[model samples]
Target: MGHFVIPVTGKPVDYVAQIFPKNNLIDHGVIVENAEVYRQANSDKIKVYG
Candidate 1:
């Protein structure tokens, strides 16, 4: 959503999205169904999408 820059040895370069970034993710349903567990949340914004 935003542009970023990364510093190399010489100069800073534009940051690009990586295809194989290390991440921890889970099923969307688990998040939606257990939304209440997020104590500090905007309940109105939580939604389930197909």
Candidate 2:
């Protein structure tokens, strides 16, 4: 499986966790101040999760 790191903003980390299913989303948690990493499949067009 491919790996990727997606940066998210303006949204609760837990909410992101709930939105994206666990099967695809490996990690959806806070990385740093106002930043979160949504590790999933690599894609040229990433869904902007606010």
lDDT of 1 by residue, 2-49 (tens): 432321222111121121132322212113222322111222233433
Which ten-residue region of model 1 has the weakest summed lDDT? 11-20
- Which residue pairs show collisions in model 2? none
- lDDT tens string, model 2, 1-50? 46644546556444555444555554533332255333343322223335
Best by lDDT: 2
